[model samples]
Target: MSRTVVFIHGLWIHSVAWQPWQELFAGKGYETHAPGWPGDKDTVAETRLHSEGAGVGVDEITDSYAKFIAGLDSPPIVVGHSFGGLIAQKLLDAGLATAAVAISPAPIKGIKILPLSLLRSSFPVLSRPGNRNKVVPLTEKQFAYGFGNALPPAESAELYERIAIPSPGRPLFEASSANFTKNAPTAVDTTRAGRGPLLLLAADEDHTVPAAVVAAAYRLYASSRARTDIIKYDDRGHSAAFDHGWRQLADDSLAWLDRQSL
Candidate 1:
């Protein structure tokens, strides 16, 4: 029997966002399962309706996913994007995944990069005033810098259109802590047992998860025999999953997973 491919989407998206990847993967003799986060709805519209106040914490999302993964008859191979990539790492650490893929996974061991553009992109919602709970949409310029700086106008616009909702400020706030020490007790763990064959897909032009950040996470793998490879894309932006050449990421993932005999 074939192992299941469990997909965990990043912030601002639901399970349906992974449809394209799922369709492509299923065609290659693989089974696919993308589960929703704690407060994520079944569809994009509903996800938008969920609002910022209803957002799930990193642990909530991870633990909820853990329950779903645990019930599986066999450990499913896991894949994630951006924040979802971090979640994927957590799952792998927990020994839940057979193998894992992290596409533009955000900072874990603090990759060194002080790009103001990347920091400002998340500023809209991350550094809010008071306990304001609302989803703040990113401006066109913000979208371009934060997610699609390297992509053309048409591709960037399509991605901006799909920017369903804003992520919760708490995750970002905690993630931006003073060396994660202040938040480590509350944050999700990316260092766990099964840390299976791990693949880190780093987009070369990605503004959010820059080369430095991805490289840093790969370096801190607690696993002894962990296989981590960083695959760079010339024109792909932070919104790589929706980019025109997204097929390459999917194909590379399929090939890597195939190599693991999963």
Candidate 2:
């Protein structure tokens, strides 16, 4: 059987957006799966219409994926975008993944640098405490600024119409206040020396999870002897994973996996 690859999507984006990635990885001789968060609808339109995932938090999302992976014949290589990136790392550390690729992953517990753009990108959920128990949808303008700032305005708008969906606010609140929270859900075991190789990708122009934030996450791995590497792309945003230029990121990921002999 072919080695498996599991793609995890982040907040505000539907799992279906990973179709192109799934096709590409499959062609490369990898079996692929992109599972949605717990309570997510089968389609983007349905998810948008009924925000059943309102109160889901990072712990719940991570656990759901863990359960999914537990049933697999073997541990798969995990790739994740935004919040999914964090989950990928967590899975890798837990020995549930053969390797991990975290693209523009949300900040883990030890990261303290919060860029103005990150705050703005999270405002849709973080501005009000009440939003913690509700699903919050981003306006087209907000999506444009947060996910597609590096793309043409028209392209950004079109992506918003196609793949965007309301996401739970609880994860944002949990990640944002992770440093102070005891047993924070956003925490990652960065110091695991025996964990699989990790590749962290960052878009220099990403408004949501800035490169600085990813750097901080990389720093948290300083104490670990595990192979942790990071790559940064110029003039790209958080949308790099699903945008027109997504192939570049995917190709690089394949190259990195080859280098690691994974």
Candidate 3:
């Protein structure tokens, strides 16, 4: 039987963000699906115009993705980025994913290390209280500082033009207030036996989810009986998966999946 891989994109970008990843995995004989979040548009331009995507929260996003995964013939290998990474972990907790990879995942409840860079990266969303119900778009300057700081200026600018989109602010607010919120949806049951093998990939220079943040998440999953590991790439930024060396990230994930025998 052929294995299936589900690619989950983070905020700002829609399912199209995973096109390259889908093709790469398809070339390796894995069937792939990249599902958009609820209210997601077909393209960045459309999403920017509509902007309702930012109103969706963690619970709604997780529930939507869980329903989609349930319809698959079998559990898929879930791979997610940023907020999608948080959703991947939630799916694994619910016994929906056979194995999982989370790249620069957003903070789940209980992760307390809020680096200065993370605060800066998230400021655009959190700065305005009303943004919880509004779409938040990143300026090129913010994108360059937060997602593409490690890339060359020209490449960073090109990437910003190609993939940047507006994101819902609610999820960021939820993540920021996770620890204080009652029954935060970002909380994961780290002790689930059937959660399966997991890998957390971090970009060493990522302004959003830095090595320290990734390490904290890995530590949370340490209690799991299933194998859990983390890999950090040097000099890469938060947008490593979409940047010039994205293939390396894909290859590393494939190699890790191979080790899991998934």
Candidate achieving the largest TM-score: 2
What local lDDT score does residue 72 receive in model 3, on the 0 to 100 scale?
91
Whole-model lDDT values for every prediction: 0.71, 0.93, 0.88
lDDT of 2 by residue, 1-262 (tens): 2289999999999999999989988898999999999879999999999868989999899999999998888999999999999999889988999899999999999999999999999988888999999999999999999999999999999999999999999999999999999989988888889988999999999999999999999999989999999999999999999999999999999889988865
- What TM-scores do the predictions have? 0.87, 0.98, 0.97
Write the number of the candidate with greater TM-score, choosing between 2 and 3: 2
- lDDT per residue for candidate 1 within 1-262, as digits (tens), equals 2368889887655567688999998887778898877666666676666653344467777888899988888888899988788888778777778788999886764445645655776677667643233445556677777877888887787776764455555555546662746545223344443357789888777777776677777666544455666777766778887677778899998888777754
* Runs of candidate 1 exceeding 4 Å displacement: 52-55, 110-112, 129-136, 178-194
**Which stretches of candidate 2 lie above 4 Å from their native place?**
none
Q: What's the distance in Å from true for residue 208, model 2?
A: 0.4
Q: Which ten residues in a row have the lowest lDDT in candidate 2?
A: 1-10
Q: Which 10-residue span in candidate 1 carries the lowest summed lDDT? A: 185-194
lDDT ranking, best first: 2, 3, 1
